[model samples]
Target: MKTSESLLAELARSGKPIGVGVIGLGAHGSWAERSHLPALRAVPGYELTALSTSSKQSAERSGQVHGVSRTFGTAAELAACDEVHLVVVAVKVPHHRELVRTALNAGKSVLCEWPLGNGLAEAEDMARQAQSSAVPTAVGLQARSHPALAYARHLVADGYVGEVLSATVVGSGGAWGATVGPRDHYVLDAANGATLLTIPFGHALDGLASVLGEPEELRIRTASRRTSAVDSESGRHVPMTAEDQVVASGRLPGGAVACFHYRGGMSRGTNFRWEINGTEGDLVLTAPIGHPQLSPLALEGGRGTSTGLAPLTVPEHYVRVPELDPRADAPAYAVAHAYQQFLRDLREGTSAVPDFAHGAARHRSISAGADRLAEGGRIVGP
Candidate 1:
């Protein structure tokens, strides 16, 4: 088997845009259409060559709508296509394992969305497959690629905070509220693997880990405040088993305390706020709502005896991809940066972007924490 280095070198030497095939291109209001399509368009070195949907008719229709000629009804068909150099799994969480495996088995690179699998086992299995395939892989944890967050991470590392002491985060889920949409009802079921804990809280935690290091000795508590929600469109009641509130507190490396609290639904004030306090300084990140991976974030900091926090502008160099507004609230902004990083990794044979292995590690951490929570215990990290 060719090593990852050799495969990247081969792709670099080809001097052609990578042909990408995306699975589960729904008709409308799909993430693929909203974020992935626009992101792919914004970044160079990639071509949307093929796409697949649940049926041949829908696939052809989406192909025409997206201006792609090659469409398939099955992921296997798209993965086998000679024109497809990269296979993107953009479907629901439950379908990730099957589609990702199909692409990996066909010896194609893959870019799977976050919450990489239904749970830890599936994520580990996919990670093992990607390792054996020796191909480039990426998971959609775009919050780490956000320019503001990236700059904040650098600031923390550059001693702007002067030895981290503690961090606190509070955010709203934006879903799991008193009402559910027809398209989003699936997330209400804990079995569906898109619960508040796994989506909004999970993304925010990952972004926090990227900056403050992973939380250790974690104590977690979850509650479902709203047992049922009314369907906004149909006036029908839907049972919600997923936890609507999650709280976790722990210590980061270097003995800094970390605490997170996420609740279901939006708040009239302070929908998202994160503050990192240190011996000599403090940094704060905020957004209109939670899901830092999707929303734009603002950074503020005060260091060395400053009276109050002030907005800190991210330098232009942090916006690795040009021609895109980093401050836009659109989902495509951070996604475009992620795609640029992935392209750079492929060309330079670097693993800058989070891959399947990274996703699996995150899954393991979450799963372990959840298990301990179930046993009414705290998780002690390695």
Candidate 2:
């Protein structure tokens, strides 16, 4: 009978729990298990009540593994459950639109993973649904929650680093080119699935856009494409449709041009680094410690001083919020935090970010980039 805010405050003060349902039971879903479930258990106001999977067996397995009270064979069943006030969709790109619509239409809040939809049309349609339904929706853009990046932005805005001149982000190391699972096998074919370009590249670019602002001109070039030794479920070498290595250049609104070099299959160490250049100084954004490559919603940066680049410490505030299971050292826990934030925004009446519009814009960028590649690397916008 308590109001949502009052309940949240009470939970924060007394360690109560919020009821939540999670959809999908794959690697990302398993992430929900290792990360979200524990974090939600640690948070003040959260509870894992239900989970849904395409197969009942998978749902049962997830339910047992995550310690959830119930398991539903389908997303709709989970959405309609009275015990579930929030739904977390960690499914594939293809199923996002339908599962999200189901949860929203069922009067449940939703937290969907990245790339809201596979294409612009799907993202636009999903956004329209979110708008019309008035249901709170959160997309996976956790990098915005990072603290080091936050400090960088603050320094930039405050002119600690003078007006931005230009920037470049290079994310290299490891071979994501090899097909990992049955669900992601489609990714090798650009036409069938969203590959590094749409998934990892999107995250990298989002980080870039977050610090630099929207780009005025964007151009993309893929060096080469070839099938790897990785075999798909179909027993054939999945055809690599998109370029595994891509170089995208863009001019920020302030006339600062940025270049991004991404190599999926490389021998270098697994590192994600970004740099921002200005008239006064330079800032190097490095992956934060404590959280894994994908988990740190917070980041770290190096600011140039008169002598050398000084370490800029940005507090990790995004994961600091109190939850039922307050365990650290796990990146998967972020998905739960991301989910809880989505529902918290809904219950608290704040604007949900990376909603339909954000997803649509990214989708547009993807489509536009593909078009440019087809047209021999011309500039385009989404």
> Best candidate per TM-score, number?
1
Give stretches of model 1 more than 4 Å off.
1-9, 12-15, 327-329, 371-382
lDDT measured at residue 16 in model 1 versus the true structure, 0 to 100: 67
Residue lDDT tens for model 1, 228-311:
778889988888878878898888999999988898888888789999999889999999888899887889999997989999
In candidate 2, clashing pairs total 20
> What does candidate 2 score in Cα RMSD to the true structure?
5.4
lDDT of 2 by residue, 112-140 (tens): 77778867788889888877776556677
Please provide TM-scores, in order, for all candidate models, with all chains considered together. 0.94, 0.80
Q: Residue 152: error of model 2 in Å?
A: 2.4
Q: How many clashing pairs in candidate 1?
A: 0
In order, the Cα lDDT scores of the candidates are: 0.86, 0.64
Model 1: lDDT of residue 130 = 94
**C-alpha RMSD for every candidate:** 4.3, 5.4
Q: Candidate 2: where is the Cα deviation over 4 Å? A: 1-17, 26-29, 173-175, 178-184, 231-236, 288-307, 316-330, 333-349, 372-382
